[model samples]
Target: MDRPALLAALRARVGRLERAGAAAALARSQAGVVHLSEDIDAHLPQGGLARAGLHEVLAAEPGAAAGFAAVILGRTGGPVLWIGPDPDAWPSGLVRYGLSPAELVLVRAPRPADGLWAMEEALRCAAVGGALLALSDIDLTAARRLQLAAEAGGALGLLLRPDTEEAGPSAALTRWRVDALAGSGGSAHSLGDPRWQLDLLRGRGSTPRSWTVAWRTTTDRLETEGGTLAAPTRNRRRA
Candidate 1:
């Protein structure tokens, strides 16, 4: 096999082994998974973001990452818990993304350790439909703890970390990076709908992929702007 193909195969094998334990657990929780767009779900092992699994979202742009994550939680039928150092997410901003403020539970943890603790507790709470932790960094151990917590609680755990953090190995079912994209001109009176380039850096039994999409308020859905690709350029973040 070619050098690139060989390396890719080896990497995929390693990822599978690293996540082997959680695979069976997540498989059993497929009924609790929340489906995204059919196209995006097609590439995910659980057919969508498994509600009882942990996922990572790189904070390439804080707003873009939060917006994307919010879009995911909007699909859920229950409350969301957000734990982080910042408590600046006001209701008005999230409403447009289809996430209601009333459904959110915000907890501010000034210290990193405190934030992790809060996230772990929230993830393991069955009452929480989703838990989002905004962190600057995380290790494989911490990621695994949160992953297992999500499994136990039947809630989705989302880690929003800075893009500068090395995209190392993790226990997350999927890692994503969302970057704000230039708006496509349409409404002269508006700045155009929010657009983002989404990179699925890695997934369980799924090849890395990229999609450009816009959150259309009128349609209340994330529409793929130019469709999707099996793999984006190497310049983009990958794990």
Candidate 2:
């Protein structure tokens, strides 16, 4: 081979090796956990949320659940994919949750099957940081597929569903119920920061717990009253 040709081939081979090394490192994390925040990390068995796993969020109110999911993804550090039957893509509200609409990709799938398909495909993309699906219901098989896809891509997967007294089991690593809480402010007329009651109904190797928290826009941090990552205000037994 000519000198230039050999050099070019060596460069190409080096590039492939670098990519492989990155994938290997990510695969290790896929098999482990991701440190989300100090508040909730210690409570989890893996010391954090599973990096490449599906998590279910039962929405006491759709808006609150959606907000919480966005907050989680904002810390994930990459482009986010949001899929739903019908999505209200309001840019203004997303900024408060720390997601830039410019970096968010929204997919609308009117049919349930289509939405599920989109979610799986998005989750399997290596470049995507996170994927959120506002699903009405998810079965075990479908949930497992999502879990596998997340592992393949090393991305966070979130399923947002309506809260119910009886929610069927799924392949999700954790299940959280988010309820909107009344905001506090100096005056009743002035709007306060958003607040929510977060209930960790179930998580692999973790007991059920709850927290009442608020997002402070001034500091751009979500914290309990004492400026902690998460303060457990209550604990509940699984039904």
Candidate 3:
């Protein structure tokens, strides 16, 4: 099949699956494992965020966002399959966040569509403890399908996209906007500093907030102050 046709088919299948009762059952069965960071709790107001099921983290850029998401999944301490077309150059810093490079299964695809397909197949595999699928671009329909698949598999699905694309409504259970922050180390802090500023754009059963978090590179820890940035009371609806 042609690329467009194949993607359309995948989207249709994923949509049907997401609406099926099995998806909700899968999410419920997989709901107990989410462990939110102290900083995340402060911003969330709800003590902690949901861990199981599919959540979306939207970012203005791919680097910081993908790294931040990696840090979250790294804590699961399970085999992770990182799927992308450019797997050879997968970020090395993921190791610093507690993910053992040896435990990662890298799947390389030739195109964005192929990468999506590979991600679906990998997440469907029960042997995989968790999976992180990085995409350069995706539409609303495709994103919804991925969210469903992650829900069914009980895995964390992180979608990394440009800031321009994230300015809209999505089917993800939670949405996060992350940006770089000043490193905690002295003025000499360089590329690997374990600190970040994350904004919780949207979440279920909670308000939107922002956090100045210290993301430890060595221990894969996320810490933040005891306050949160209140979400705007009124704003334009995302597309």
Candidate 4:
């Protein structure tokens, strides 16, 4: 193999070894990192969300994936710019997930092509804390463009793609597939806080895994059941 290819392989091996220790992972998470729960953090090499990185989200159903994105934005604790074909953002609906409509800036593009353009431009703005781009189609080239822009501006960029969009190739730091599930509302008469089936399909320096988590409206936190199975606990805070 060439020298560069040999170095890349060595780096990948080192990353795997670093993520194998649970105790070391826990320490990194506690030291000013975003808490995604112990189980989830253990699987991530960084033990938390990568700052100023691009993440791609896909859903079996449309609205379900968007809800999960709201959870991420809430944790980001910054203003969000959503660029899509329509203004589907409902401030009241997003409150349960932690993002208030007041913190949102909606930009409606006439077409998917236009939305992609707007997404890159928005990521270049320093004032924009986070950005979500809803596009029906994006190739590897386009995806890399968005990624570079986000890295330059030091912001998080969420590429919201359709369920049919095959997860083939991309430059995103992480790729997630989110699906909503029905759950007990605590009481018989009402629906409970939104529950979702989250799949980490791909991430740099991490293994792919799945988990079920629910949004707790009262505290604006992601309630997980220890990891993959157990009962929900409300101790974790979103921020």
Top TM-score model: 1
Please, what is the TM-score per model?
Answer: 0.83, 0.80, 0.74, 0.77
Candidate 3 residues lying further than 4 Å off, grouped into runs, are 1-31, 42-52, 88-91, 189-192, 232-239
Candidate 3 lDDT over 1-239, as tens digits, reads 56677557645644454455354435534554555586566445446544444556666546667677777666554556676666642546677666677657666666887877767654554334466666656777877777677656665666655555336767777777766665666677455466666777777777777676776666656777556656523342352
The positional error of residue 52 in candidate 1, measured at the CA in angstroms, is 0.5
Candidate 3 is scored at a TM of 0.74
Query: Which consecutive 10 residues in model 1 have the weakest lDDT in total?
Result: 13-22
Candidate achieving the largest lDDT? 1
| lDDT tens per residue, model 2, 103-174 | 587777777887787788767766566788987788899999999999887778999888876678879999
Reference-based lDDT, each prediction: 0.77, 0.74, 0.61, 0.70
Can you write out model 4's per-residue Cα lDDT over 1-239, one digit (the tens) per residue?
A: 44355346534533443355334333432343344556777777888766567888886667778888887766655567787889688878877777888668777776777687777866754445578998777888988998899777556789888766355777999888777778648666888778877777778987667788777777776776546633223332110
TM-score, candidate 1, is 0.83
Worst 10-residue lDDT window for candidate 4 reads 230-239
What digit string (tens of lDDT, one per residue) describes model 1 on residues 42-114? 8787787778889999978889889998988777655676778886666689888888987787777777777
Better of 2 and 3 by TM-score: 2
RMSD of each: 12.5, 9.0, 7.0, 13.3
